[model samples]
Target: MADSVAVEDPKFTLQEVLDTFKSCLSENKEVFLEHYVAGWLGLVRFMNSLGSVFSFIAKDAVNKIQILINHLNGENGAHYVTVQSMVKYELDNQLVDLTKRGSFPESGCRTLLRLHRALRWLELFLERLRTSTEESKTSVMCSEAYNESLSQHHAWIIRKAAGTAFWALPGRATFFDVMNVGTPEQVVAMLGDALPLISEVYQVTEDLYVQNNILDLP
Candidate 1:
């Protein structure tokens, strides 16, 4: 049986985004792609709201995502289909800058790597959100997940910026409301359960990277 999550009153806009994510994760590959792109666009907006510092990283992320989105929905998806191919395309074109010498420091590979790294964090966070026995503070869960995953790969500046974003996170009530799940309390409980599965996915990826020594594959 499918586990059903119910929310009493959902705030339409952002909640729809999260709802879309849940739907994507649960079913619908094309929708999943769209939601992923939409979710990052929101994230970029959220980061931009912070300050100039985040603008740099967010700009890089947004650019790379736009590239991927174009490839996915464009005429060149066949060549940019896989993460590996995307990396090659970006690097070969000199679109990626491995070191931060100027505005664009993240290559498609590195940018994707950052997202890939964050994916682990998202898995952990969602799992935590899914399985919680009580209402969870999305801020806390987000920070905790980052510490274990994305934050490690980030430099000092990014860690500080990401931490700031975590603190700026909406509370459980708003977070769940945005998620369109039934009731904040119920959603928290669900997150607690979901977190472990997400962690498992993160761990598996982490292990694979460590084994291949491809931590910097981008």
Candidate 2:
């Protein structure tokens, strides 16, 4: 999952990413790790298309996605199928470093937690984008979303760097076009459809981590 990594398709629409997110949740509320990774793969591709400025953010996300991908493709992949199952398996086996970062650096629980936090940022950012008007600024929307969500978890240096990148964001119209989802009206409609699913997936994973007391894992 390098920054130069190629996604499944070069021109995938936001709808495809939405479909992946939609599939991430099972009928019984299990969040499929594979689908979750696939959804992130699409988002990372979108981030890469934005510009080199966001490469740092995309790289961190890619690294987390790779960790989950490794666990999903590993020998014990069956136990790592769903978020709930992965949490149970990893904790039961003491495979997670719940305190400070240690041997289990690639633990699925911790890896997903990082991505889970980012997902909140995405949810907030997209909501802002959906409600934005012609005079609205994508940079401001992105900055506001980051502040409300991801900024708290990030270090001072990371936050400063990310804030600078926000100012380099495209205008609202260009942002909507990059989504490849028809017109701005369509993009807003698409967001309306996609946000709830993303929120649900985020909540399920959040609740799982909170219950396991691994929500703040190092």
Candidate 3:
């Protein structure tokens, strides 16, 4: 299946985006790489809806997603089935460059690590949005979320660009309405329901990265 969102729906509802991510988590709590990438694609759509200021970040995320999709369609595609399986396959077969950069610049481990870090930022930002008041500043919330999660991985230029994008964020009420999930109450309720799944996926991937000592991959 194509990693891109379906064309049948030109606009994305927040619940639909959350469901994409939620579907990534399997019954055993393992995350499927295909579904996870799809979830990010959904998020990119959400970012696009926000406006052109966030296009740069969405572009970077789309590039990463395409790289993973290439691997998923490569000769060793079966090994790239799920996040857990891909990590094991790469580590066992010596496909990842643990300490230094090598020919495989886009190793599965490193690529997933970047997305995994961003996932935490999304989770935090969403939670903040869910609980925030009508008068809350979205730029502040977004910058705080970025600082606490994805900022460490980014350079000064990227951070500055991201800060600018955050400043372009719509008001809290507008953001909630764009979700297309009905009233503010409904949006919050949906966010509450979706957060645990996102948290579990992040924690599971984080633990896997820590255990294998590839969290700091170059």
Residue 118, model 1: Cα distance from true site in angstroms:
0.9
Cα RMSD for candidates in order? 8.0, 2.1, 1.7
Best candidate, lDDT-wise? 2
What are the runs in model 2 whose C-alpha is more than 4 Å off?
Answer: 1-5
For model 3, residues 82-159, the per-residue Cα lDDT tens digits are: 999999999998999988999778898899899999999989998998898888898999999999989998899999
How far off is model 2, as Cα RMSD? 2.1
Task: Please give the lDDT score for candidate 3.
Answer: 0.87
Give one digit per residue, the lDDT tens place, for model 2 in 82-162. 999999999999999988999999999898989999999999998998888999999999999999998999999999999
lDDT of 2 at 215: 82
Q: What TM-score does each of the candidates earn?
A: 0.58, 0.96, 0.95
In model 2, how large is the Cα lDDT of residue 182? 98
Candidates' C-alpha lDDT? 0.56, 0.89, 0.87
